[model samples]
Every structure is written in structure tokens, then in C-alpha cells.
Target: LDFSIDELAGNVATGADTLSIALCKVSAPTKEPWLTLSYDEWICVLKGRVLVHHAEGTLEAKAGETIFVSKGERFRPEFPDAGTEYLPVCLPAFRPDRCIREDESDATVGQQVNDMHAKLQVAEVLYHMCSKEDWEKSKADNAAYFPPMFDKDGFTHATSVPSLLLTVANNFYQS
Candidate 1:
């Protein structure tokens, strides 16, 4: 019931690749890359409008309207109106491979998504999964070593037991 939309971005909430449903909020007018899907997709707009450009031409859908993109249809989605909220459902889910984006060549939405996913996955693996890299870093660090993301993260994770600090650099941070 309580989950982050960012946590769902570039990833699925269902944990199943067969299907995915996500609510997307676009606060600013933004444009997305041309995407060719391997799965059928339905996008229902909840607020503002969405502009989709395809080979045939362009299609415009506003609030309360729904747009369907069949498999293999290539298109670019744009949110011309700020504060656009929409729900996108994908049949067979939306993997990076399933969503072939043409903007990977540049630092576009696809690249940004991949980058975000990489950072999130790294954090998950290093913190939750306890990778050897974290072990080495934690072991070698004698002083209060905050990771590179400490500033943005605002706090460091610490252990309840001082002796177990070797096992974890930072945990259970309370600010």
C-alpha cells in the first residue's frame, strides 16, 4: 500500500515480468525517446495531456483518455502539459529489452533510467546483499568514512553493536 513511484521506475512493483502497471507523474513538460515495444501497452491519462509521435504521424490524448500502443509500434511520448499523471499498463511487462528505446545513444530517458536502476541495484546489492566491495570498503575504513553519496543521502547507516561495525559501514540511520 505504501511504496515509491521511483522505486517502481525502471522496475516493476508486481515482481513479475509478465505484466506491469505503474502510475507515472510528470511534474514538468517532458519528452521521451522513441520506443519500440515487444508487448502491448495501454496508457491512461489521469491529468493533462500526452502527445505521441509515430511513423504515421502524431496522436494527441488528453485527460480521461486512453492510448494503446501495439507491439512493434515505435513511438515517442511527450508530455506537453505540465503536471501530467498517467497509468501505463504493459502486457508481458516492460523490461529494458522489451522497451527498445532509440535514445540510448544519448543521455535520454532510457539512459537516465538505466543509470538510476544501476545506482539502485548497486545500493541494494551492497547494502542488503552485502557485496565484497562493501566489506573491503568497510574494513579498510578506520575513521568515520561516509560513502560518496553521503551528502545527498544526508546520513550514514550505523550498527547497533559497535563490534559489528566491520560487518556494516552504516545501518539504521536516524536523523
Candidate 2:
């Protein structure tokens, strides 16, 4: 599909009860920091490059690269070098109410978390990889947990050992 620099363009390609896929086209450089409370997002970059900055650190992905941002992980994605086209596959479908912007002011952190859990239940432990900087910062702050982006949403995204972690990385995250 065609894209325009004046707008952020995207469309849901397909969706099911548990998942959905969307094609996103960004024609200009931009940065958006966001957290998804109810679902996980796996992005496959088709063209250009994007730098994703998370609580832990930053990862740069270019064409044919993929990035998985677990639920509750707060991250700011910057399309820096050029416009980008990507596909975002979200588990459990993506909803506006569950996607919280970093600067959103209406809900308190506690309320957000409560509301999120009220809607869904999590039964498994997930793992997330962070940058050394974020780890060090947490230590200096004497905080045991570096809250995920969707902490406000009440749940965080994680990958079990047997999940598609390595396969996904190998398939999409390779330089």
C-alpha cells in the first residue's frame, strides 16, 4: 500500500479472538513511547530502521528485522534514518483502552494496573531482557523491579523458555 509522510498510516490486516496483525507505515521520523496492558506486540520491520528505547535500553532494527516488546514493557520507538514500513502482530488483539501512552494523565498507576487485571488473568511467569544501563539504574535507585511499560495496565509481557524467543529473534532480529 502507498504511504504518506503527513500521516501515520496503518490498517489491520487480519484479526482473531487471540491475535491480530496490522500493516503500519510511517513516512517521517517520529518517536512514540507506549505500553500495552493486555497484549504482546511483535514487530517486523519491512523497510528502513527503527530504534526502540525501553526501560532497560535501546535496540536498533532495520529492514527484515523484528522486535518483540512484551506486554507492560514501556518503550519509545524512533524511526530515525528514514521512513519505515512494518507489520505488528499483537496477541489477544489490540484495544485502544489497553494501549496507554507514556504521558497519559487521567489514570493513576494503581488504577491502571487494577483495571488491567480486572479484565484478564495471567498464569505464567514471563522473562524480559533489558539493557545494562537500565539494570544499573534500578540498582542505584534501590528498586527491585524496573516496572514494565504496561505496569499501569496491571500485567507485564514475558516469554517462557520454550516460547518462540530464539526462533523469532533468528527470523526477524538478525542484522
> Number of the top candidate by TM-score?
1
Instruction: Write down the RMSD of all candidates, one decimal each.
Output: 13.9, 16.0
Assess every candidate by TM-score: 0.58, 0.50
Instruction: Provide the global lDDT of candidate 1 against the true structure.
Output: 0.67
lDDT of 2 by residue, 1-175 (tens): 1232211222122212356566667765655546545678888888988788887899998899999988887787676754688777777665455577664453343253344335443326545555588778888999875545445646443344436455534553346
TM-score of 1: 0.58
Instruction: Give the alpha-carbon lDDT of every model.
Output: 0.67, 0.60
Candidate 2 off by > 4 Å: 1-15, 104-175
lDDT of 2 at 35: 58
lDDT value, residue 61 of candidate 1: 89
lDDT at 152, model 2: 67
As a whole number from 0 to 100, the lDDT of residue 23 in candidate 2 is 61
Q: Count the backbone clashes (under 3 Å) in each candidate.
A: 3, 7
The pairs that clash in candidate 2 are 18-92, 66-172, 71-157, 72-149, 72-150, 73-149, 74-149
